[model samples]
Target: MAVEIDTSAFTEEAYELLSELEDSLLELEERPTDIELISRVFRAMHTIKGSGAMFGFDEVAKFTHEVETVFDMARSGTLPVTKALIDLTLAARDQIRSILDASRGGPPADQDNANRIISGLRALAPQKGGAAATETKAAAAPKADAEGPHVYRVRFEPKPEIFSSGTNPLLLLNELRDMGQCRVVAITNTLPSLEELDPERCYTHWEIFLTTTQGENAIRDVFIFVEDDCTLNVRLLTREEEQEDAEPKKLGEILLERGDINEEALGKALTPLGDRLVNAGVVSADKVRAALTEQRVVQEQKQQQTKAAEVDAVVRVPSTKLDKLVNLVGELVTVQARLNQISGRLNNQHLQLVAEEIERLTGELRDNTMSIRMLAIGSTFNKFKRLVRDLSTELGKQMELTTAGADTELDKTVIDQLNDPLVHIIRNSIDHGIEKPEVRKAIGKPLVGQIHLSAVHSGTSVLIQVKDDGKGLDAQLLRRKAVEKGLLSPDAVLTDQEAFMLIFGAGFSTAEKITNVSGRGVGMDVVRKSIESLRGTIDVQSELGKGTTITLKLPLTLAIIEGLLVGVNHDYFVLPLAAVEECVELSPKDIANSHGRRIVNVRGEIVPFIRIRERFAMDGERPIIEQIVIANVDGRRVGFGVDTVVGQHQTVIKNLGGSFQYSDEFSGATILGDGTVALLLDLARMVRYVEMQETKETGGA
Candidate 1:
């Protein structure tokens, strides 16, 4: 029976390789002489081609093979790394992605585009019989051999079940032989008799002696896919050993290097080593033969050496599986909460102890599960490099993207949703924030503008900023535009910070004319909505001449959050624990002293307050003594007045459907211990909404 292949796995790996290929190709254009980058590009394409063929992505394999051949020529210095080459290769990478996408029921890739790229590459390739052709032939010679060919001893001990995975060891051996002059010896010590042998299982391993100039990485690339299922050791036989005085390693040394014998065992053995060890039950005949074969091969090359070993075990898991796991964990958290409520009601010591233990484990599990979903934001950052490069070229501007703290991790869900908003920000920076090269020179600024994209951890939040040093947001111009668009009154007086925020207002643009990229006035508003939907906030800081900086403050995860549960009359609400500062009592006398103003004095600081019950329009009389939950909104201190403080709760956020989705005051809702639903407060948006209401009440102050 034939084994069925999972084409989706192949497509996924191909897509990732294609992405890395694009990044490598772009970097190659910057450092044309960097051999490592070239090798990386070649490896990515080679892996895609090899895996594509294996998974029957015939068209992908065929197209990639052509691109790979061209890159191979470049790798060997037969072709120079040119901007034209990078362009063609990038186009080819896109075509490969399109092909993979087509396989997933998307639009078919354009065959004409693929052919054009191939033709362009062939045109760049060195032709036969000219000076360039002769130069190419000379360059094609083994580069490593220039320093003298190196010999290596390789041992491949494949897992017995390799055959079940559709791997053919013979093909791997052939690939090794193709690289250089190689000798292979198969060991059958573990093979059973016919009656006990399993045809589907691999029983044999092999030893290989090879003299090659492809370098170690290329050798390892041959075994890349099977590395996880086999014991592979490749050791260099130093060139000095080839000298007249150098000798092959001793039998004991060979055995030790093969891990078949230890130094102590060898020291205890007598002469005629192999026969002595076998007779003494220290070695088997098969092991002795394998060692002798290695000894003979080394004699031809006259060298021996050893290398240390390191292994990393990795298993690729589908993101869907992780999502299911998180969902199950959320359910478990809910169940654990129910148990805690029961234990509290029963007042049973043993039951309370059990509930406490379960609660601790559940919290740990939730953290671990969320950690699994936390991916480095760098992958998202790398993609923007291409966007910046393309936009700079398209708009005739000179700008570069510099990034920091890319290793900052966020939940995969948030990261995925974050891409569009980031793209919009970067595009705006390129089109509006960065100046054209000539314009910059005229203004005495650097010809190439800089867009600094950085992220850093702040408490339980990640702060991502896109800053640009160009003609910054003109606060006066923004104010005037806001007035003209009726977003602000002519008599309105605003600080520079407030004026800068006018850009996020819908249909607000300072551009004199519209362009394909940004002037339609749709991006920043969408950005604000997207960030807020993730329970995040966006801030703007800019100067007249220097530049503009947009900062996004987002939570570490959206799945589950530590929330401060508070009660307003009969209903409960949760404020993100990270945002909650302190809670205090608000007596009716304090309210009377304030003359009905929604503000409280904490210490010497006057804090503005929001009455949750009034804001949500809940019908209930005010409590004689209300509790005030002081929280940080943006950078200001604010208080949320509620009936009581219900303590901290680990909230598994559940999206509010139907009409609740339209409410800006609550980001989401969670189930309480007693099965009641508690709405999560969107403090930033809530503050803005209340302030806007007050502004209207005060006649556009």
Candidate 2:
């Protein structure tokens, strides 16, 4: 079969590598002296350059080569890693991304940016420097001399599909030639019939004799990117001490040197048995030495093949395909639930056994599919490092962002939608929550502010908190702003927590002046809407003179939920199981003692309750005995009044119709096994509405 060469595959791999490259650059800035990080940065750039040239991204390859050269100098310790070098490298990284985009017809790269970076790099790391280049070359030569010069016989044979990956075998040969003296002979015996030839497949291999003062490590570095893409072998023909005086011998030495002697033994033997044993196994010294050299090259090649056979390889699958598999698993879950219900009602032993087996299989399948979709949230968090760095510089603030719980995992879909909302929240923290350096110093706080972002798994959800150590929100000022905007009555009294929440209201802003970053009042409002759309909740906690923490609670996945199915006067509803804390009985005496307030006293804790029937305007007679489901809402325990609890359900949530989509009381509706539609309540919205009503009633009293 012909090689399936897809340009999109190359682009996808390039994008993933670029993200890693950006991450490495940011890390290198923090630890400039780390050798491993330096190596990582160099390798990333070299791969991008080589792969770009192979796939027709000529401009990308050309621009990246210059960046690679800078890092190469860094790896050799010829050029010190400085802040200016880091900045220019970052700019070059962005320019490469622009080139990739332009290659695929997104837009042309910024020529000014490319030129500015190239100019900066050239100014700093030039080929011919007056004193620095001389010092560097003099410095690097000894490091090589310490290892001693050796002749290496390298055989490079790329897979037939190497062209598809954008690699040119000739380019690799050219790199070998640059290392020192290299003789290359291309073998075209693998060439196929013209009728059967594949244009993209490589049909040639090369045998190379490289005489380099650089040692074996240097030769291996040339083929690092193609480690898995080709067959490579580099064998040493001389030792350190011998190579001190052992440059390649004349043709006469080639025909007379003995093969049995190791380099150490040969050093002394070369002077004595100079013409005794030319080759080990053949009669003619010239032809035998040639054959034995080929034998060692092939032997080293076999060792590499043997080593490669032991490794387990993983293939990359497209995310779209994984998404399809998840959807299929969801449907299977629904069908399995239906089978369970039927088997329970029929009471047939055989049918019941089959249903149990199907349930077990379905559960395992669902778990496996979920595991595939789960990705560590750290990747998302790492991207914000650059954001914080750039913003801190732009705003002229001394602040550090500390993070924790990076290993927490979330659904890919949820993480994708979370980026913009999180950006808005973080920007707000920097602009409004964190005080300036002078202001902070005047208030006896540290000169540099601290912004801490943390994520942790809570029940079936993940809680992400973005906390800042700066000026806390002034509750009084927020109340005043709410009154001016008509969001609250002037006489309305609110708890500190309630007052802090007013920032999420539309057109709410306490900023005295507008700036480019966060003062326009469009941020928090949209943040609330976006979080609510994901069936999540956001809450704020602050002190008078201390810092503020904003917490977001979101489900691990959006498609399926573990729900508590309930019935209120025959209308069904589903409550997220993560939110449910307990179930309690609502007594008549408790209601009478509260004097018209809907509440319950549970183990010395008075929790406010809301009747689902009244909230939805469902017409039903009050049941004498009722069940109250206690849940944690906004960090407080609240209760929901329902008629009966119908056990747990694996709810496959579906979107609401267009007319009902605007309503905030319910997030979405789920289909039940019996074909009944259960509306999934947005508990946060209902709790907020309930609190507002109680505040008004208490004010009247």
Candidate 3:
């Protein structure tokens, strides 16, 4: 029977490889002499070409071959990694993507564009010592450091049920042959008789002798996906041959190592007294031979350890699967919480004990599951390099992008949604924020401008900043723009922070003239909306002559958060623990001392505060002394007055649906152990609203 192969999977993988290929090409342009980067580009292209052909993407294979050929020249030091080469390769990468899309029955790509890129790639070859070449030939061929090909002896045996799982072992062997020289010998030790044979079962295995320059890792990669389904033993034949004088250990030493015989028995077995005993019919030769055979098997297995040790155990599990696992764990956590509540009410010691253990286990499971969904933000950060390059050229502004703290991790869902808002900010930086080269030079600044992007963990949230050392936001101009656009009252008084935030309002623009990058006033508003949709807040800071920095505070994960639960009259609200500082009592006398003011003095620092019952207009009597949760709201300390503190809760956030979409009071909600739904407060928006209301009241007065 013939098994069908899926070509779509190959195309998907090819797309990812092409993306990495472009990233590598861009990096190579910056560090043109990085051989490792060059090799990375080569390998990605190589895999795409090979896999493309196998999966019947002949056109893709052929097109990638042309790109791979240029990189081959790079690897050989014949062609240098010049700016021209990088640009051409980037164009080729795009062309390949287009071709892939066309292959999937999408719109056909322009042959003229593909041909032009191919022509440019071909042009790079003839300039060995010309304009494109930068380094000497000796410097190009760094791969020569690889000593030589290492010989390996590999034994592979598939279990009888291997065929049941639809694996073709021969295909694996063929892949091995593609790496280097190889030999195969079939072993049929367990072959059944013809009449009793089960045709569906795999009965034969093979001993493969392989020699490859790719090293043990490459060899092991062939069996990575199917390793557990088969028994694989790979050993370095060269090492064994070099250590030809490895002496055979005595049977007694082998028995001792295996914990079969103790020191007394081993000492007796080694001496002539043991031999005399065996000859005098006190011991059997068969027992001695069996121990020696066991020793030999252990010796052979030990020799195989070096090759096996190099392989890293990693599996690429799909994100959807991880999400499903998290969902199930979340449900379990809910159930465990309910159990704990029930056990407490019933006062059953045994049930309580069981529930406590489940609670501990559930916490660990929830943590591990969340970790799986956490990916470093660097990949998302690296993508902006291309954006910076292309946009800078388009705007004719000489700007360079520098990044730090790329390894900061956030939830995968957060990262995915973050890309668009980030792109908009970078675009704004390039178009509106950055000054032109001549203008920068006229102001005693360097002709080239700088845009910096960075991310860092702040409590339970990640802070990403996009800063530009170009033209700063003019507060006077922004305030004027606000009035002109009818976004604010003509004579309204605004603070610096309030003026800067007006940039996020709809139809807000400060451009002197409209341009393609961002003149129409839609991108900034959309950026805020998108960030806010992720339960994040963005703050803008600028100095007239200095620069502008936009900081985004987003939760680490949307699925689960560390929260401090608090209660009002009959309603409960959860504040992100990352934002919560400490709790203090707000006595009636403290309120009386403040008169009508909402600000409270904490340790000699006056901090503005919001009373939850008053803010929400809840019908409830005020407590004589209320617990005030002091949290940093957008970098400033603010107190949230609550009736009582409910300690910490592992809040698995649930959306409040479209009904509460426009609400500024609560971001989302979570279920409690007692089957109550508690709303999760959006502190940043809540605080902003409270301040806005105060401003309106003061203005009215």
Candidate 4:
């Protein structure tokens, strides 16, 4: 069971490294001469190979080792970074992922494709009697280190928290022992007494004398994962000292050389120096014994430069755990609201003060927890680079995907669900929106078309836009196609915006013919459904022969939001406060002035209003003066009239389930402080619904 858990960890790390590797490979293509990019590719592959071997992934290790060797050659300037090599390496990376997934009971990897990738890689290499076949064995053989068996001294002092990080020091030592003749001596002076001991903490440090043909770098590589968590220093012995292996050095000389004891103290120690020094307090007992052990064997090394170890600052956590934490916080918020309600009803000043304090703390906790799930959208943006690259090649078009504001953060759940919608939009842009290279050049545009994806924060919402420089959507053609397909009436006159929105209607397509990339008429419909599911709105803007821009306005999170609570008769509703502009009074006189129309004049601005009581089919006496919650709906000012305004709320959203699925009016529901369930208005959808109703009733007025 433990072994499986460890392998699971390695798999997760490999997946992340693979993602980073993909990004580096894509960037390396654009900056072929970038040494830093080359090194990044090499390091990612190297870590994957080493960790794979450590966790019993022999196939992963063997395959990745081959790829790592090629990058190693590039690192050493032996191989040039070429497009072909990058292509082959990407194929190899996919193979590595396949092997990892297979080990976890996934489908077996495609061996034929794997072989083709390896062959391609070898063909690109500078061959000497087929070196690729022998590189793996050469990596394990010590013949490459044919020089004299050099001696290295290593001091490893791990932090007390090392064991908790799932590192085994003994395995590291075993790896070192495999490299050469090695002796490990442990110093126990740091060990605490039993009463003070913590079983989980590491208290032992070690000094190692190793004789190996491999250089110091090979030894350092053994501790690569834990280097930041330990103090490690490795040095090589001088050639002259290597020849003096026949002579045993005294303890005093060793201590004096190490600067552990003063020369005066060392000189005062008598024969049988190690015990005498400890007795005289000239040096600690552990230092004397460590030196005596050094004398028994060959003393290891002199001073050499050391790498300054950095502190490890990141902790890997499972997403499921974060989800649980957010859920718990949501429950706490509900409880806090209940407390606030009780405090208000009791009319106790002390209790009210405590309730207010609890509310403040709960809000902070909610914000912090949501931020934990807020990942930069850049990670998702990168995957599309590969998609754009592959699709452009397939479509025989010269195109580029440019992105901005990738560091904009959104809820992880929002980002996860967003991937498919973005893919659909980009695919449509590439296949139908971007003209061929020749067509673009003839049109006096650049030969390469551009698809720009950008995100920005707007109030409490995020606006993501996908814009493409190509032959933009033709509203006339869209309207004609819709009429022919029975999606619109032949004599009907439609606005350009309405015609553009027709693409999202089911079974609507303007393509001349069907192709693999699109033209089944399903992509835009999927995009619309998906965005709406996340409580987001999509807008389209385009001009013929210019370009098209699709903008999606989305809430920053799905779990919680700042909402305006309003009441209508016996029920309540929550409006997203970000979209609420202001509130006004709608009196009976105001209704009579408008001649029974659901429109009002608010401070010289004419705005249409929806009667929430009538819209929801609730039969009750209307208030003499209703509060009209004026909100910005899709660039238009609209109002929702309710019985009273209920102020602001820290609303934890809950879904209204399948029973309410038939209506697109209410997006979701939330629990109020007084235990009332208030429905959240899908303002954009409701406005469109009302507009369609009015248009039909007035015969397209």
Query: Using Cα atoms with residue i matched to residue i, what is each candidate's TM-score against the true structure?
Result: 0.78, 0.73, 0.72, 0.75
Error of 1 at 514 (Å): 2.8
When summed lDDT is taken over every stretch of 10 residues in candidate 3, the lowest stretch is 130-139
lDDT (Cα, tens digit) per residue for candidate 1, span 1-701: 99888798788778778878878988998999776687678778878989999999999999887777777777676788999989899989999999999999999999999988977877777775433453455355444443434778888999999987899999999988866678888888788999999889999999888887577877888899999999999988656434545666888988987788788888888998888998888777878887787778766654223211111135678989998999899889989999999999999999999999999999899999999999999999999999998888889998889999999999999999999999999998888889888889988999999999999999899999999998888888888988898888898999998888888789988778888897888998889888988988888988877998999999999999899999988899999999999998888778887887898878878888999998988988989988999998989999999998989899999988988867878888899878999988889889989998988898776
- In candidate 4, stretches whose alpha carbon ends up further than 4 angstroms from where it belongs are 1-5, 103-105, 131-311
| Cα lDDT computed for each candidate against the true fold | 0.85, 0.79, 0.80, 0.84
Expressed as tens digits, the lDDT of each residue in 1-701 for candidate 3 is: 98888776788778878878878888788899775687689778878889988988787787777777777667655677898888888887888888889887889988899788877777677555522342233234333224334566577879888887889999999988865556676766467899989998998877676665456766788898889889988876454334434665566664455344467655554356446435645344444444455445435544554454444245656778988898888788878878988999999999999999999999999999898899999989888999999998888889899999989999999999999999989999888888998998889998989999999998778899999997888888898998888887888878888899888888899887888788789888899989988988888999876789999988889998889999999999999898889998888788888898887879888877888999889988988889999998777899999999989888888889888868867888989888899999988889878777777888741
For model 4, how does the per-residue alpha-carbon lDDT over 226-297 read when each residue is reduced to its tens digit?
Answer: 999999989774343243334456667778876679988877888787787888886778777767666655
Q: Which segments of model 3 are wrong by more than 4 Å?
A: 1-3, 31-36, 101-112, 123-312, 596-607
- RMSD of candidates 1 onward, in order: 13.7, 15.0, 15.7, 14.5
Colliding residue pairs in candidate 2: 54-166
Quote model 3's TM-score.
0.72
Ranking by lDDT: 1, 4, 3, 2
Ranking of predictions according to TM-score: 1, 4, 2, 3
Model 4, TM vs. native: 0.75
The candidate maximizing lDDT is 1
Summing lDDT over every window of 10 consecutive residues in candidate 1, give the lowest-scoring window.
Answer: 303-312
